[model samples]
Target: MFPIRDHNPSERTPYVTIGLIFANLVMFLLTMPWGLNAEGLWVYGALYAGAVTQGDMMWGLLTHMFLHAGLMHFAGNMLFLWIFGDNLEDQLGHLPFLGFYLICGLAAAAGQISAEPGSTIPMVGASGAIAGVMGGYLLLFPRARVDVLAIIVIIVKVFTLPAWVMLGVWFALQLMGGYTTPGDSGGVAYWAHSGGFVAGALLTLPVLLRKGGSRFWSRTDGHPPHDPIDYGHRSRVPQIPRR
Candidate 1:
C-alpha cells in the first residue's frame, strides 16, 4: 500500500518540497547510467554514497540521499515526498523545513551506520529522509485523512484513513523489517526509516508544543485547519442502452 494523496491542503505553496523533488530527479538523471549498470552502481556508490566502512567516514552522509539503487527506489521516495511533504513545509515554513529535512536525513544515515558499523555496502536513496517527513506528518496531523491505494492479489482498493493509522502502520512495518532484515544487507534500510521517523517526531515536538500542545490538537481537533479536499470523486462512465 502507498499513499496517493492527503485531504489536508497547504496554506501556502510548498516550494521546498517541490525543490527537493526536483533535486532528487535531477540527481537521478545525472546518475542514470550508473543505476543502469551494476558495476557502475558499485563504483558510484563506493565513491560518493555513504557506507559504513572501516575507513574514515566520508561525505556519503550528505551525498547518499541523492543516490538511488534503481528507478523504483527514486520513484517511491519521490511519491512519499509529494504526498506528505507539503503539509510539513506549510507548518515548518521553507528554510526551517529544509533544515529539518537535512537533520532527519543525517539522523537516518547515523541510524543505518549504527545498525551495521563495519559494512562496506553503500546505503542510498531518500527513503530515510521521506520517512522523517512521514514522522512529522504523523505528529502534526494525526486526524487528517490520507488516501491510500492498496493492491491485494489481483484486487485494487482505495481507502481513506486517518494520518495516525496510516503512519502508524508504516512505522510498525519498518520496525518489523528492521528486525527481520539485516542492516546494509543490500535491501531496505529499516533502521534508517525508524530512526528518521523518531527524529522527525522528536524534532517536531517543540513546534507542536509551541502551537499550544494539547491545545493545538483541541483547536484543530487533530485535523488540518482547513477543510479537506475531496480527490476521490470518480467520473461516471456513460452507458448506452442497447439499440
Candidate 2:
C-alpha cells in the first residue's frame, strides 16, 4: 500500500516544498548514469558511515539527502514529500520549514552513522528527510484523511485512512526492518527513517503546544485547520475479476 494523496489542503502555496521537489529532481538528473561525471558526483555527494565517523567527507550528511540510488527511489521519496510536505510547510512557513527539513535530515544522517560507523557503503536518497515530514504531519494532523492505493494480485483498491494509522504502520515497519536487518548490509536506512521520524515529531511538539495543544486538536478535530477537499468519489477502484 502507498499513500496517493490526502484530504487536507494547505491554505497557502507550499513554495519550499515545491522547491525541494524541483531541487531533488534536478539533482537526480544530474547524478543519473548518463549525466555528467555521475560516478564522481556520487562519490562526492553520497554519505558513507565510515567516512563520517572518521571525520572525513562530513558534507555527505547534507548532500546525501539530495541523492538517489535510482529512478524508483527518487520517485518514491518525491511522492511522499509532495503528499505530506505542504501541510507542514503551511504550518511552519517556508524558511522555517526548509530549516526543519535540513535539521531532520542531519538527524537522520546521525542515526545512520551511529548504527554503522564502520560501514563503507554509500547511503543515498531523500527518504530519511521525507520520513521526517511524515513524522511532522502525523503529529499535527493525526486524524486527517489520507488516500492510499493498495494492490493485491490483480485487485487494485483505493482506501481512505486516518493519518495516524497510515504513518503509525509505516513507522512500525521501519522499526521492524531496523531490528531484523543488519545496518551495514547496504539496503534501506531504516534507522535513519525511524530516527528522523521521532526527531520530527519531537521537533513539532513546540508548534503543537503553541497552537493550544489539546484545545487545538479539539478545535480542528485532529485535522487541518482549513476545510478538507472532497474528491467527490468513493475509494472503490475498477478491478479485474479472477477466473
Candidate 3:
C-alpha cells in the first residue's frame, strides 16, 4: 500500500518537501545514465559516503542521502517525505527542520556503518531521512489523518487513518525487519530505518521539552493549533498504467 497524501492539508505550503523530492530526482538522473551498475554505484557510494578517496569527498555522507537506486526507490522516499515532511517544516520552520532531517539521516548512517563498517556496499536513498520525518510526525501530531491507498489484486481502496496508527505500524515493521534480517549490508538497510527513527524521536525531544511538551500537548490538545481542514474530494494514488 502507498499513501497518496493526507486528508488534512497543512495551513502552509510544504516547500522543503517539494524541494527534497526534486533534489533526489535530479541527483538520480545525474547517476542513472551512467547505468548505476556495480562499479558505477560503488563509485557513487564511495564518493557519497565520504570514504578515503584519493581526493576529498568527505561530504558524500550527506550528499549520498539524496541519491536513490532506481525509480521505485526514489518514488517511495518521495512519497513518505511528501506525506510527512511538510508539517515538520511547517512546525520547525526552514533551517532547523533541514538540520533535523540531515542529523537524523546521518545518525541513521552512523548506525548502519557501525553495523557494517567494513562492508563495501554503497547505501543510497532518502529513506533513512524520510523515516526520520515519519518519526517526527508521529510525535508531533499522532492523531492527524492521512489518506492511505490499499490494493489487493484488482481491488483498490482508499481511506483516511490516524497518523499514529499508520506511522506506528510502519515503525514497528522497520524494527521487526531490522531484527529478522541478517544485517545484510547488501540488501535493505533495516538498521538505517531503525536508527533513523530513534534519532528523529530523540532529536525532536529538545523541541518538545522547550515547548513544555506535555504542557504543549495539553495546550494544543495533541493536534495542531489550527483547525483540521476538510477534503471535499477524496484523492486516489495515481496508478502508473503499464505499457
Task: Find the candidate with the highest TM-score and give its number.
Answer: 2
Candidate 1: give the clashing pairs: none
lDDT of 2 by residue, 1-243 (tens): 999999999999999999999999889888888765467777789999999888999999999999888888999999999999999999999999999999999989888889888989999888888889999999999999999999999999999999999999999999999999976898899999998998899889999999999999999999888889999867588787999
Better of 1 and 3 by TM-score: 1
Worst 10 residues of 3 by lDDT: 46-55
| Poorly placed runs, candidate 1 (over 4 Å) | 34-57, 232-243
Report the CA-based lDDT of candidate 1 relative to the real structure: 0.84
Q: Is candidate 1 or candidate 2 better by lDDT?
A: 2
Candidate 3 global lDDT: 0.77
TM-score order of candidates, top first: 2, 1, 3
Clash counts for the predictions, in order: 0, 0, 1
Give candidate 3's TM-score: 0.84
- Relative to the unseen true structure, what is the C-alpha lDDT of residue 223 in candidate 3, on a scale of 0 to 100? 71
Give the Å shift of residue 23 in candidate 2.
0.7
lDDT of 1 by residue, 93-118 (tens): 99999999999998998888777776
Query: Residues 1-243, candidate 3, lDDT per residue (tens digit)?
Result: 767787556767777778878888777776775554444543555323225232345565676688877788878888888878988888888888888999988888877777665555678778988888888877888778788899999999988888888888888888787778775437778888878988998888887788888888888766766777777666687878999
Q: Which 10 consecutive residues of model 2 have the lowest summed lDDT? A: 34-43
Top lDDT model: 2
Worst 10 residues of 1 by lDDT: 41-50
1 versus 2: better TM-score goes to: 2
